[model samples]
Target: MRGSFRIEGHAIASEDGMIAAANGLMPDSLKFPSDQKLYEQALDQAAVIANGRLSYEGQLNSPRRKRLVLTRSVSGLAPDPKNPNARLWNPAGESLEAACAALGVTGGEIAVVGGPFVFSLFLGIGYDAFHLSHAPGVRLPGGVPVFHEQGSGRSPEDVLAAAGLKPGPVQRLDDGVTMVEWTRAA
Candidate 1:
């Protein structure tokens, strides 16, 4: 089964290489009002692959949620055997390819909404598109950077470009935020 992958990153890129605050939580200042709607739309008809931390701390933790896969490096933690829509993956023991197979996910978009590590992982695997929303005039001084290499002096755009993604036209969102779509180069 051929699956398409896309990543969504919200808010301004931080100076530090972190997706959340030092406390591992997303702060209010960086959040945009429209992010919730965008996230809902992305998750509407697609399966979601998210980092373990995010899965637990974010909205994916809702007991009623379905079609969600959480990837973690730790052992002894597996997806509920009874829930076909939820899956737990140990990347160290199993390959992402294998995990996808077990999840029975095929032929639909997989939204990789992440922390930096998750984003970094998919960056190497490649993406069909990346939806990046930046909140203007906001900067996270000690907050995490959107890309892993951002701390190394490489911008997120540079990283995407290096991965063969081409930027599309910019679209405006609420509160001075701008969203850009980056698609893989043909």
Candidate 2:
């Protein structure tokens, strides 16, 4: 945990490290019941969830957990007109700490669900742990990578390692799906 904040990231990506198709949408091929269950459970324990507009829109009916939606539409932090439990945020204009403070979230798990940009932002900020699940036999070529850079000779593992996170032992989830908990390197 970093300074009383237990930041964690959750994502399910294709074998090729794509989290979304070229159309900027997450394909069904990446979804797994096992992963969804774990993702929901993790979110339930989090004090606040943060994601980009696309990620936030994708899960519109998600349980009413407090959320911060990243968008350039807001100068900094502003009320989400549609959801009283949410806030529209522009990290470029304000610090994450200030955004969280606006939502009355002092310290607890900050669950970061993602599109590539959101994931990349948190990677820069640092994560206490990242739960990465893979859908075996699936590949989304020319799709959105879990990290920002692609076709750059760096795999998602390389990106995570560069961010100082080490993978824990792998666990088989379901139907060939596997998961690895990446934590800060000791």
Candidate 3:
């Protein structure tokens, strides 16, 4: 945990490592009821959700959670103009601790939901754990990857492992979907 907060990343991707299609939209092929159930349960436990604007807007239930929207438009941290329950944060200007303090977040899990950039950001910041769910046989050749470096030939698992995270047991969530939790190596 970093300063009383545990950071966790959550994402569902296609087998080819794509989280969204080329248009920056998650295709239905990657969505599974069981996977979403688990995802929602995790969000329910988070102190605050963090993500890029695209990731936030893609979720219908985003308004239900206290969140941090990563954006360069904000100088540091400011009340989110679109959602009263959120803050627009510019990591380049302010640290996550300062942003969390502004949001009145004392301590708990900071769930990092994402667009590729956001995911890549936390991978560098370090995650206590990352829950990755994948849909087999689904492939988005030119889609947005789970990590920006994936385009340079690194798989999501490769990226995570390189960041010092080790995968736990994989669990099948549905017919063609499976989930795994990767934790930071000791």
Candidate 4:
């Protein structure tokens, strides 16, 4: 099966911990229609590659589908623990590819959902789909910059394209963020 977009990040949550974009953000219900569409896209992305964070272990955090939390430790997660499909783990690897190797995941189809560092790490290594939603040019004077680190290099799209992702449609969110979807070329 297509492993889907590869997103890898590190955070010292529980061994099986992970966090999703929706949880990290303010209510998406407050956003405008276009922006909401983007939010909905994120919510609808059946599989999300997230940073291992404690938030993912919530009884409520039980993923609707398969959600993986990649860590270097031996910790594990199970929303029900009883359900065989629901899983969590900490793999040994310094990079996503290495972890994917251990997990048997192909790693090409992943979207690279990031908390910061992961996005930066995978940007050029074959990053495909980028869903960035900001409050349309809205900036908090003292607020943190959204991306892991502002790229002093190529535009995200450029870097990823150079890495081998096929450019797809780019959708603008009424809020500051835009959804850039990319696919690996066949």
Measured by TM-score, the strongest candidate is 3
Q: How many Å off is the CA of 60 in candidate 3?
A: 6.8
lDDT: the better of candidates 2 and 3: 3
TM-score of 1: 0.78
Ranking of predictions according to lDDT: 3, 2, 1, 4
Of the candidates numbered 1 and 3, which has the greater lDDT value?
3
In the range 1-186, model 2's lDDT, one tens digit per residue, is 135688899988898888899999888888877888888888888999998888853443464788889889988889999878888988888888888888888889999998888889999889999999999999988988888855585778888988999999999986789999999976
Residue 106 in candidate 4, Cα distance off native in Å: 5.1
Q: Each candidate: what lDDT?
A: 0.61, 0.85, 0.89, 0.41
What are the models' TM-scores? Answer: 0.78, 0.93, 0.95, 0.48
Backbone clashes for every candidate come to: 2, 0, 0, 15
Stronger candidate by TM-score (2 vs 4): 2
**Clash-forming residue pairs, model 1:** 18-144, 18-145
lDDT tens readout by residue for model 4, 50-128: 4434324322334453445544444443243534433344432244444444444554444344444445555545444
Q: Which candidate number has the best lDDT? A: 3
Q: Model 1 over residues 95-173: C-alpha lDDT tens digits?
A: 5555665667543566666767767777777778877776666655666666676766776778778888899998887
Better candidate by lDDT, 1 or 4? 1
Candidates' RMSD to native: 3.6, 2.0, 1.5, 8.2
Candidate 3 residues lying further than 4 Å off, grouped into runs, are 57-61
Off by over 4 Å in 1: 1-18, 55-77, 80-84
TM-score: model 4 vs. ground truth: 0.48
